[model samples]
Target: MPGLDYFSFAEMWSPLFLVFMLLIATLYAFVVGPWRQRFGGVEAVPVVRQLAFYGAMLLLYLVHGGPLSLLGHLMFTFHMTDMAISYIIVPPLLLYGIPGWLWKWAFGRAFWKPFRLFANPLFGLFAFNLLFSFYHMPDVHDWVMTHYVIHGFFYALLLVVALLNWWHVMCPVPEWSRVTSLRKLGYIFANGLLLTPACVLIIFAPEPLFAVYNDPQVWVQAMGYCVSGDPARLLEQFEGPAFFNLMSGREDQQLGGIVMKLLQEFVNIWALYSVFMQWYRKEKSQEDDPAFDHAASGRLNNV
Candidate 1:
């Protein structure tokens, strides 16, 4: 890990994204808290919703704007960790954080027809997995990591699709809901299945799959996206990623893939449980209805 410390930026922390996150939280507060009457009918956003939004912003900064971002550039394992948080965790948080009224206002507008189409359960499932799988192709992955703009664009797309996918399940806004209670299980399971092949490809590769992670030259070039403050210093002192505990480059890559798949499984299972419980409760409530009791009694009297 000694050589890997070169990628650490404890000495020179970048606060650009910290500032940006704060600005976003502040703007949201203004729009949702004080200026609500001016902008829309939403005058009082719930405190919990505010907390969710702020939490997501802070997590985003920690992952992308903080030292963890540096680690991601240095190692593929950290990179996949970054992806899990950004796409898997953050999107649902964002969906839950924003008020349903806000979503309704947006969806009620003229352009929501297309939004509804894209955010449909089936479409989100297919589109996100397809884009995600394509992104992992070694050549495509290498090119993306090496170019900062494309890297940002690709990740941004991932986040958008992630949001769309989760919205089908959470559907915080009532109008845009696609999947019914039972169908949610199928939707979530299908997503995990689609995502599994990509992880398996990385996990079972006989050799390292990503050159940006395995090849020192390719790694350094991609590293430039994070370690922007000092190129010459890095040139003189750069060493490849550390594979601790007798792990080789391929082993490290496989570990990353394993971690990605594990996180996905955990999230999907939690979602399935949540959806199933909600469905179960609704069915139980219907059975407990006074109308249902009266109907059963009438049938018994006939007997």
Candidate 2:
């Protein structure tokens, strides 16, 4: 039977092709317009910084939003490798690539008042984690797969959470600009730690948390993508039906749990690198400073 095919999963790659073109165009615009205007007046940032931020964004987009997303859609696992990395990992890096002025021009003006109100640290920490937790709830996850609007909304909400969580770490408000290199590093690690529970739950689960993982109808419904032809093909390759039959629900759960743990490990490594490098540069700066004395040395030592 040709399944509902509502999402046209096979064609998932099509939109990304268009998006890739648009992304290139946007990158060009940023480079030629805002990036140029912003930096033209000031000393250019080091090539290394630019490369690290830009290269990271470009690479992340390629791996997550671009081809990898399409591949995940086609493959149908929705496993931890893509979900954690795409949702939890990539947004911060992408935001880091945007020039400060561009961030100010874009989100800092019209939305500033409302955004500031909503993005308080307390709100940010709760709202993001709360929304994230709820979105992955089985019913909500299923709903997103079934309807385009819900799916888009979920993605948008995820973006908002990502932006909020990253605000203090990457593009902090002026009032809160006192974040030193050590502080930023700590922030990243904190986030990595915060994500551990979710990762562990998914990775060590006795069974799949989401019902869609086991049932084809529910899975396809939740995926909102139609499958066709051989039910066997869909069962064998895409839905992990073979594994589902062979393993206890507890075993399935544990698989997801493990995958989440691995995902956190990746995030931990990346975040550690980001924080350490930031602090390292600050250390280098202090070392080069003539004002450095015993007290300053003590402070550095404390850091």
Candidate 3:
């Protein structure tokens, strides 16, 4: 296998981003531990929640600033895998990991009220899917990839919308949950359905849709964001992204789409099972309650 050892350590590991992630993790530990009293935390956070938060941070670092990030630049498959992990997988983990008290403390301020509209189920549903699909459009993708500022901004926007979209399903704060358990199932289904068209376009296209992957010149230009040294040297040393890719452009593109779709389905299935079980358990608990039974009988007798 072609190894990434050829690349500089900075390019492969992104030391700056690594430091940023570590700082954030350290800050989180403090905020949830020593600083919890200042934040009005009533009790210690669960160990499982702490683990999930750290796990989310680790995954984020691996995909964005680790070897996988470098691989993503060289191959369409890894790029799509990065996308799946970033938007689909990471958001839920973050939502589940963070404590409800922290969520309230952070967003409970009056200034944040205006942004609450983003939490609307309908807005969350369409905004993320629309932006996600729009981003994958060939021209848009190429333009964004080539422009560093726009690339960073757009990705940040995607992360925000992804967190918003997932908020309905994860609902870290029980009181803040907008969608019912039954509706959350529908939300997951709608998410899978909305993302299908984009995946289909990538999977079934006769030719590779992205110039950055197929054209050496464009590929090298995009490399500027990930590679530290002069971009010109990249073409001289490695020739192009093709030097690193093992499959044909079309095959890589198809495989990327397939991988993304499969991962989405897998996450959605787990979400469905979770929501269904929650609903089932709630109903069962209600059934076993004498008060609930009496209320049910009273309502039925009145009807």
Candidate 4:
């Protein structure tokens, strides 16, 4: 119910409290559930990993979505970068690193049917991409940037798509659905390819695209009043009010794009390696076993 703003986020009730809730939920899931069962009765992820991950995510929210978000509202480059990474990269990695069962228990039942539909290969991939692309269009992007509810919904939808996309590549339930190692590798690379054009456009575009990028009032509305210069001066250099000249925006947006692409490549390489090793081992085992085909056939039919 609290709004998204610098003081609001810094005030302990907004992002800080939201982060605490996330920690509590994660702790409960790991400690009371999987971690408890897995490690004899004790429950704790390696303290270092959990702490580091949460710390980074918290800092990121503070920097990008908090005070910095205000500055970005004035600057086209910063805003673009903020939207790209906050929506595309950070959430998925954070979610993926989380123990799978915890997420399953949290959103598993209530959102199960929709989650599955979204996770479906055909439905999930294209729909999220379409929506993501459309949301970034100038008018729609400006609208979402201007409205609180729309912004929150856009971020939430992006996270859902991220979850589904990752699930297809790293499935926890093999019985429900699965892709071969080669296929998983292929899927990741394909994702990389699909997201590439947008990154290129953002990085290489000759000038700003959205109205918020050029107008001060719109930029302020989009970013929440965090700019560094006189509103008039900032508007003078550019045709409009976009934090048009800030290196921060250029650095942030470009780096975010690079990070997204690189992160995808890293995960994909790992997945490819894993799949290849698994398949090679499986194939070798079959070669040594005379009854492998019959056993495989039986398993296939059961599925």
The numbered model that scores best in TM-score is 3
How much does each candidate deviate from the true structure in C-alpha RMSD?
Answer: 4.8, 5.6, 2.7, 6.4
- TM-scores for the candidates: 0.88, 0.70, 0.95, 0.67
Model 4 agreement with the true structure over 32-90: per-residue lDDT tens digits: 45666543443354555465456546545644445545545545544545555564455
Q: Distance from true position, residue 175, model 1, in Å? A: 2.5
Q: Each model's C-alpha lDDT?
A: 0.79, 0.57, 0.90, 0.58
The TM-score that candidate 1 achieves is 0.88
> Across residues 1-303, which tens digit of lDDT does each residue of candidate 3 receive?
484777888888989999999999899999999999888687788889888889888889988899888788889999999999999999998998788888888998899988888889999999999999999999999999999899989988999999999999989889898888888999999999999999999999999999989988998889898877678687777768888888999999999999999999999999999999998898789888876775675574455
TM-score of 3: 0.95
Number of colliding residue pairs in each model? 0, 16, 0, 4
By TM-score, the candidates rank as 3, 1, 2, 4
> 1-303 in candidate 2: lDDT tens per residue?
122232254443345545764687467456645567654324344455455455555544544445555444332243445666656666666565555655555665664776666756556656776777676666676566568676767776777787677676665235444455566676666666666666565555555666655566655453333334533455544454333244555565565556656765676677668767876887788789888685867775576
Worst 10 residues of 2 by lDDT: 1-10
Off by over 4 Å in 3: 1-3, 293-303
- Find the candidate with the highest lDDT and give its number: 3
- lDDT for each residue of candidate 1 in 29-122, tens digit (9 for 90 to 100): 8878777766565547778878888888877887788866776766788788888888888887898788787776666787667655676577
